[model samples]
Target: MTTETMQADDYFYEFFDAVSNSTDISYVQKGDVLLCEKTEVNQFGARVLPTFYCINFILSLIGNGLVLCIIYKYEKLSTVTNIFLLNLVISDLLFAFSLPFWAVYHHSEWIFGSALCKLVGSLYSIGFNSSVLFLTLMTFDRYLAVVHAITATRSRKTMYAFASSAVIWFISILASVKDMVLFDVQPGNQSMMLCEMTGYHHNIMKKWQLIGHYQQFLLFFTVPLAMVLYCYIRISIRIMSTRMREKCRAVKLIFIIVLIFCVCWTPYNVVILLQAIEMSNGDQKQCSDTLDYALYMSRNFAYLYCCISPVFYTFLGKKFQTHFLKLLAKRIPCLNITIVTPTQSSKTTSFRTPNTVTEH
Candidate 1:
């Protein structure tokens, strides 16, 4: 293949990256002819994606930041689940912090240097991977708390929680090493510098890209999702058997978290899986445009997870609501916000016990 052919192939593989910098051009080949067809996708993306990313960034920042502040101010980090929730919020914030740069990149070009390019790419990888891992840990913690409440006490200590979180961070960093090593600022069409993997030939790049897609699909989504499903299923069974309203409510909140995670990420991963299959079978040109569009739409939709998590994880909790209202009242003394005492029904449904795993 000539240089032009290689560039076209590279652009196709660029979709494998979390933050792809490719513009909208579909390369179609005929006998002794190369056709470059321009689509509205790039223009559409430039107009829409930056604004969407900015909105997502602001919402995720405020939501996750509020959760962090509330956790620090009112909630104790003694519980294993609390530790996991704290780490999860931090991961979301880390992911959100890169959004403005991406918004700029999508709107224009990569003005940032190669170092920052790699850093942002790694942040994307690390934050996303760690969020899933921490969520899975939280689900398992709840599982142990609800299912084997007596036996799990020995293992659910704060020291163990910290150790587990440290290990998760280490794993997330290791998972992101590929982005750190490969991503760089490279010149694209019309002198636009793109932050993408640039040095490898088309075939080599495709191999690595496939590896990345599969790695993310398996490690980030598949395995963690499986664990979450199993934990939640067991928790549901335990709750059903015990008929404990408190456990049911606790499980319901965590279950919604897991459900939202799956809903947000599943479509993107499915698109990636289809793309991977197409690439592996040497059928990249078929449905290339369709997959490109699907990838963009689904990936943007997946970003909603970070923004939505704070609501389900913190604000929906009765305890968190009370704490937030109290904090608000303290901050604004003129506001007559009265803290309501727990009614009998509220007490019966309360999941905030020393032995239970509650959302904070």
Candidate 2:
């Protein structure tokens, strides 16, 4: 109650609007204690609770599920690069699976039991942290592949990547277990009770909550972001300077991944961080209409990024598209496939396709 964060029952209309049109300036007001109680929802906003959760659930299921299916179906796609993808899809699915429960908690009263309330909320946090960690790692992997060719090719490097993923998942689970067990539903709040640090064991709960936030920042926000930025800078420089034809595919893949990272996550964290700072001071400051609007806007756009991640593979990752197009051509019997052999006069080859391929 005293910490910085929007209460569980915060409204949606302003939330969406604020996030969509966010400002670079911090929303934190000095001398604010976060002790706001929920009031009646007097028929405002377009019932964003259900809409937000439903859209996120459906998108994550379809898109992340497809990514999983693609990797599992094709043996060749199980490379070092795609292993990171598999982690990403799995993280998205973990987050998405809990959306329906949240939607129910929002649309209908929290009819799903207390056990589910804690479980869903905890998993959501875990998935979010894992997603950030994996995306950052994936960027680093790409950066290494492009910048340090021999190291990337070594067997030990691949082993180390897998080892790192295992550690990330292990820590993510441990971080999540506390929420799953310790979250106490507020008295008489129906389904509105989400994960919170109860004052019952104030000292312990506060420590855990701060630890969780710090861990999330370390793995997800701060360190990973710095790594990603550095990697992208190095990668951009390498791509611009080098004339290596073979490296083009890898460069494009990394570029799209980096772009998605910036677009999806930057807004949500900014809101939370600023909110936290404001709450640390002792005033229960009401979120300005502008701040509320930006926070919600970021929430919607953030999930869209998660859902559209699989599509990035189709458009930007060259290897995925090649196999996918071939498969699509096979599925549509009416479509003709054209094959041309190399004319080895020079070091170049040419091929003609019968139709334009659409990237998913």
Candidate 3:
């Protein structure tokens, strides 16, 4: 064979071997010969993603932590909506806890070993699924409170809220089982270790990854998004018909919550869908390169949702804002701001804070 043919053959052999060991290989065609190319996605991720992850970690930690403390100190979890809020905060915190590890992993190798690889992978899976589920539940809770208030009164109890949260947690754990089983500390380019799926035949590994993509796209994104849209539509119709401007105002924050969720997650899931399609169709170098950049950027943007959620979910609430300011003033006596606690009247007693005045 000629020198060029021999070089192409060598490239094929190297590609085969790399595929057998790792799924991070891409192919580019050079002068009618397909050559395996190691993508610089990791290097790019190292430069960009670690900064984003670190910022998200700090903001999510402090934001969700303050939400938790405020809920525990000032708010009563006697209402169903409050219970769901508590669960959502917990989910965000759980997800936030995994970011520091991922930030470090992107910056360097997976030095935490196999056990932590599985644990952190599973934590991310569970946190993401649970966070989406809890948001959907909260949206539904608002729908009932606004559209079917009387009919939902008996069903929307704190006990039922706890039961629903338990079920969501169970499903989230089930979703993470696959990650726990497949993720490990695997060798990557230049002998670096990565926390990724391993321990299966190359073909089988690709199938499993594809399955995960579809599972997340369908179960976490498509289904929940549909439910949220339906609930909000019904809520809007009910409120408009009743001419309750206050009711519309009450749900404005909830609408913002759902909007933020959609804006943050939709791009990431769309990228995953495109990636699944690209994987099934074999390698397209340009497409693969584009996807790698899109995935990292969009995923980091989605991570910011956990941090922004606290502001819309709790801080904007009238009572929560008052309580938080009071706490702040107390912490810094130099501010000397006086916060008056509103008296509990019969009208206000019917609702839990002005945010969800429609809810009993």
Candidate 4:
């Protein structure tokens, strides 16, 4: 804090000096407050990392944004299932909003202030949690329709669907806000603080961090996964015994959505579970490079689900697909790439066709 200490610490200047001094490639390691060792490497690969991050961010942004724009543009796409799809798109779009800033953070220092940090980080958690929750809900809807045909239709009304979604999002918000509150920049470290839960209170941080991660697995992964498996198992049984072709369509959609959900989240959850096991086993050291890389890959690749979710809707849901084709026609005449609908929605009503059944 004193002038002497300030003069003694010159990491910023040293960093630039080392970068400028090396003709080919250089690296700097801070050994102490004033002593920094600079080595000229074959190549300084730090810049390439940020570039990759930026690329991923751009791709995810365009994908998620397009899904949202298309969903909102068309009227026929607005059904109950599409409503859920809309909510999912909104969450992904919001998450994409933070990716550019994250790309910047990956390359450089945290130029954004404390408030934006909190906002962005919280939004990230909220969006991911929301996505997971909705996937779970969608699976359950399928279970209800395919397994418990008569009950599903009467229970899944428009108002109740909206209410359920609202409640799920509110819970997600509550679950995610802790990450923002706990996050803090590592003292005296320039940039390079990635997203993780910080415990403000001694043991509190670790306890809460572990809880949040596992909670994600439980609510979003374990329970929902169980329900999905059960739904499909039962649906398969019914289909085989009863000889119903229409039954196949509902289960098919459900299966695709479930597969998509698992694909999107399995890697990320695996990484988290690994960390949890390590911590629980008393390995308090920094993560191994391989583990860190796995986590990074999981987080980065998870965004693919954003674009994928809507596409599945189009593929499985006849009503939304119907509207989507109409919009494509309109789009051609205008010579504009105007988007049509956000959802690939199903048109099945509460009432079932004589021998056929539809799931949520």
Best by lDDT, which number?
A: 3
Error of 4 at 9 (Å): 26
TM-score of each: 0.84, 0.73, 0.84, 0.71
| Candidate 1, poorest ten consecutive residues by summed lDDT | 1-10
- Please give the ranking of all candidate structures by TM-score, highest first, separated by commas: 3, 1, 2, 4
> CA shift at 281, candidate 1, in angstroms?
1.2
lDDT, candidate 2, residue 208? 69
* Backbone clashes in model 1: 0
RMSD of 3: 6.4
The local distance difference test score of each candidate is 0.73, 0.59, 0.75, 0.59
What is candidate 2's lDDT per residue for 145-210, written digit by digit as tens? Answer: 656767766852556768878988987787788777776455334334433444343334555655
Against the true structure, candidate 3 reaches a TM-score of: 0.84
Write one digit per residue (lDDT tens) for candidate 3, span 196-275: 87775455677888899998899999999999889877877676677454766646755765677788999999999988
TM-score winner, 1 or 4:
1
lDDT of 4 by residue, 59-161 (tens): 6566555555556775433345666766776776666667666667655555676677788888877877787677656656655666676987788777866
Clashing pairs in 4: 70-341, 70-342, 71-341, 71-342, 145-359, 199-205, 313-344, 314-344
| Alpha carbon lDDT at 261, candidate 3 | 75
